[model samples]
Target: MGKTAPPSIVVVGSGLAGFGVLRELRRLSPDAKLTMVTLENGHFYSKPALSTALAKGNTSETLVTSSAEKMIAQLKLDARIGREAESIDRAGKALCTTGGPIPYDRLILAMGAAAYRPAIEGDAAHRAISVNQLDHYAYFREQLPDQARVLIMGSGLVGTEFANDLITNHYQVVVVDILTLPLAQLVPPAVGESVRDALASEGVEWHLDRKVVAINYVGDRAGYVATLDDGSNIEADLVLSAVGLRPNVALAQEAGIDIGIGIKVNQYGQTSDPDVYAIGDCAEYQHGISAYVTPIMAAARGIAQSALGTPTEIRFPPLAVQVKTTLLPVNLLPPARNCVGEWHSVESDVDGDKHLFIDDRGFVRGYVLTRQKTEQRVEMDTKVGELA
Candidate 1:
């Protein structure tokens, strides 16, 4: 009898999640038949680092840790770069892409989310750029004028980070958000205010409890006029949208896969189709979406191992999400949405603050560390009431 060929694996997307699984697979199985399909050129860069890098005078080119060719050679995997995975044909065990169909014994979908482009009224609303990838950030950097005035939408993690970087780089910045506090979803109100004041000291104009309702071009030089929901106008040379992300689930949904906030995945990273798995921003896991670094890595490990013949359970500790605003760094482990909790300050100083969320049951549900206090991460994680 002829020697049977090794099982073929196809990974859709080249974001952190895709890379995580790729690395795990390579580590576990040498000479594995692996193919990666991606929408963009698969150069590897820290997507999270982009917001903080501008202040250090780093460009997109410098931010990329490795080129696509370098990564491919390093991992010994074939890549179909600049191609979009259009659909999945489970019965045929193939992935249909813009280029063509590729057969796969196992498929991994890590099609990360697109930055949410909120609808605004006016001609230049379409020009509000959002950076969700290296390419997007590159374009944004190239489009800005020297020391340009920037209008940033959303005071969340991305927005706050960019504001700090831009302000530090001496760019005039104005930030608008519907939320009352900066990092409202993550840090406590007082901590948010502290970071807000810190960034404001570096020249970030805040328009909280408001939204940019409209935007229009002022002149031929890419200047903009943003109209708030309250009918106030702010002028800037560039407008950046950092609202959030909506997972790219259309391809999976059309293929009859279960969908939630992201593609539904089990503890083993298996989707509704056991042969297919998902992770990163596109996966709606049992604990919620696996969008951040730690969960993505854990889920990818489980997926890679299980698909390679080991059925391992995916587990990760309670997240300590970092808000990369340099003026005042924040580490947050916020309480669950349904938890009846109150944030109480455990420690405070002029430059830093720490707060713990104690639930109605008198259990430590979550914690926040800001500025100088963020250094105590290891010491603080022990205070969690339960291991989530």
Candidate 2:
């Protein structure tokens, strides 16, 4: 008898999810032939810092922690960088790329999400810069002119963060949104209002409950004219589109894989086809799912276990959504689900304020604490642990 042939796995989209899968799978089977395909140059870095770059006085070139060559050497796997995965040949177990078709025993779609650019009448505004990826940010940085007038669309977390950073960088920044308040859908009205107020105090102008109807390119290099829904207009040197994101699922959908908000997957990160899996921003979870970092880590752990032949079962635990705004002087953590609680706030000179969501059972499900009160984190954790 002879030894069986080793399985080959192909992972598409080399973002956090793809990198996670590769790293986990390697631990599971060191001899497993793994290949990663990416649309960009397949560099690796922490994306969380993208929001605070300008404020930190960091350039896009300096932000990139590692390049494709470094990642390839570190991961020690076959990598196809700077090439797009056109589609998948499931019947043949291959990924069609710009370079060529590569065979795989298992496929992982981690291409991540694309910025949702809405249909608005505009020449250059609609085609404005977006900071979703390092590449896009790099391009925006390179093309930025001296003392640019920046207009940003959308007032969600990313939108506000970028606005704050741009203001810190001495750019004339204006944020426009159709919502009555910023971070409207994420946090409660009161909390969201506070965030908007804080950002406004930092010199970020807001056009709440308004929309950009059209955009016009000004004289040769005179910037842009942004038309508003109220028949008003503003001129700017550049515009940033920070609307939202839609997962990259065309590849999986083309391969006849399940598609929901994103590529459908289970706790094990397994798709409809067991041999295929998806993760990260591109993964569509089911039943009161939270698309945050904690669940993604759990998905990676469970998927790796299965890939290693242990076939472990893992369920995502209730994790708080922590909003990192260093200027906020508080760590804003969202209230957990199934928590019928009262939201109360306690203020201290040491800690700006401690906001707690206490359940009927006298347990703290979640909390938002200011940096001044971060020392009280132990007490909050104890309360949450009781509920757990």
Candidate 3:
């Protein structure tokens, strides 16, 4: 008797998550009929590098590490670029894309996430830019002048990193956030204050506990006036929105798959339907969506195995996020959501600061390190165990 043929697997999206899963799948089952559909040009680049690209003098084209041709040939994939997966026909086991319907025995959704832009009442609101992809970065660079004043909304990781990068490039940066301090959700108050102060010392203005109520074109000024919640106004040559990201779950939800903050998936990356799966930013496991690269890479392997008929449970260890703010470098492992804990500064020396979140049982649940202390990231990771 002849050997049984491998199942056909269709993966949606071409971001790191999608590509990661494809790479793993090929490693596990080389002969599996694999297809990749994406809305972009299918060029592979490090998404995290986008935040620091300006300071590193990297253009959109230079940022691409691999072309679609290379990825397709290398992985032996039926690749479709500049196309979108419109919907999924669950019963037919097919993906309805702009190109055509592609049948698959197993489907993986790695659609990633989109930038969340706040709705502000004003004509200039449409002018605000958010760089979630290579093309968006290209447009942002094109609009920026040699010496520009940039107003950034949101003081989170993306916004803070861009602020630092812009400052390095000699642009005046002003950051406004509804939170009282930068990285309020990830870092302790002291660490956040230190970051805010360091950035301010480098000529970056901070507007905490405020929001941009409106943005208006300044008459004959070639800029916009951002009206704040406090009724003050900020004038800038450009406005950049780096609020956050929301997972792309519309397709899954429309397909009648279970949806939470993201498309809900089990440890094996299996969705409500065993044949269908999800990973990366689009997937919400037992805890929630792990949008960072580390977690995504870990999930990719498990997802690949499950798609290959070998079920594997994904386990994400405590992951540390390195904030790109070079002014006061930060390495943080955020405490679990709703964990009963309190953060205490364990050490503060010339090397920098370290804060640990200790649960009521006295176990270290999380840690934040600054400056030279960030080198302890690996040690801290081992101590923190699995993150929910």
Candidate 4:
């Protein structure tokens, strides 16, 4: 009798996570039946590059490294681009996508995440944009005028980076956040103040500790007047909502897969169903939702091994995320959720800043570096203990 063919693997995204799993899977099993489905055109590009592209004089088209055809040929997999996965039919072992139903012996959900848009009353609220994908970035670029005034909601990593990039690119930028300081969730007060001051020096305006109550259209102008909770208003040509991202887990949830902050997956990225798995921003493991690239890559490896029958458990190291703010470069290894620790700034002679999050037992749980101090990322990464 002839040998039985391996079961087909259907991957439900073409983002970094999806490609990461595909690469690792191919490396392990040469003839694995693989297929990739995505709502995008399936062009591979660095998503982090989107925020900083304008400052470097790069356009959306310049960011794409490979098209669907190129990736399909290079990876030797069936490609389904510009198609949405409507739902997962667990019983039928198939994905119901816009194009058609795709049967799979194994399934991987790498559906990344969606930009969060907060509820605010006003006529122009629907006009507020959030650039989470290449197409969205392209639209944002098209909407921007020369020397435009931009109002950004949320002062987190994406908001701050966009502020720096816009300011550097000759745009008038204003950032508003409910938090007291920029990157309030990630960095210490001192570091956040440093970032705020640095960006302020570069012509970026900050309106912290307030939320947008309304976004009204300016009188006969293609602009908006954002009314804040403090009864203040800011006039701008465009508004960007960078509040954050929520994992795309509706499909998994509908399929009866467990979900926490994201789709709950085991150490090997397996969901409630052993044959189905998840990775990247859409997945939540033991620690939490590891939305960053380093952790996603780490999980992808284990998921690939598990899908290929090796069943390798994911062990994530201290993954430090680099914030692409040119004004005040930052590298941070955030502490675990609800971790009982306090940040203490390390005295530095270099023209930069460093801080460590030490727990009750005096163990270094997390670390942050800014400007020249970011050079210590490698050393600090090696010294920090495993993340959860």
| Candidate number of the best TM-score | 3
Model 3 alpha-carbon drift over 4 Å, by segment: 219-222, 386-388
Q: Which stretches of candidate 1 lie over 4 Å from their true place?
A: 1-4
Task: Supply candidate 2's per-residue lDDT for 381.
Answer: 66
Residue 144 lDDT (model 4) = 91
TM-score of 1: 0.96
lDDT by residue (tens digit), candidate 3, 1-388:
9999888999998999999999999999878999999998899999999999988999999999999899999999999888889999999989999999999999999998999979898888989999998889899999988889999999999999999999888999999999999999899999999999998998999999999999999865758999999899999999999999999999999999999999999889999989999998889888777889999999998889889988899978786799998899999998768689899999999999999999998889999999999999998998887434
Badly placed stretches (over 4 Å) of model 4 are 219-222, 386-388
Per-candidate Cα lDDT values, in order, are: 0.88, 0.76, 0.92, 0.91
lDDT of 4 at 91: 95
TM-score against truth, every candidate: 0.96, 0.89, 0.98, 0.97
lDDT leader: 3
Looking at model 1, which ten-residue stretch has the lowest summed lDDT? 379-388
Ranking by TM-score: 3, 4, 1, 2
lDDT of 4 by residue, 1-388 (tens): 9998976899999989999899888888889999999989898888888889998787889988887788888889989888899999999999999999999989999999999889999999999999988999999999998999999999999999999999998999999999999999999999999999999998999999999999999764758999999999999999999999999999999999999999999888999989999999999888898888888888988988889888899989787899999989999999888679899988555668889999888889899998888989998898885434
CA lDDT for candidate 3: 0.92
Q: What would the TM-score be for candidate 4 when compared with the true structure?
A: 0.97
lDDT of 1: 0.88
- Residue range with the least summed lDDT across 10 consecutive positions in model 3: 379-388
Q: What is the lDDT of residue 230 in candidate 1?
A: 92
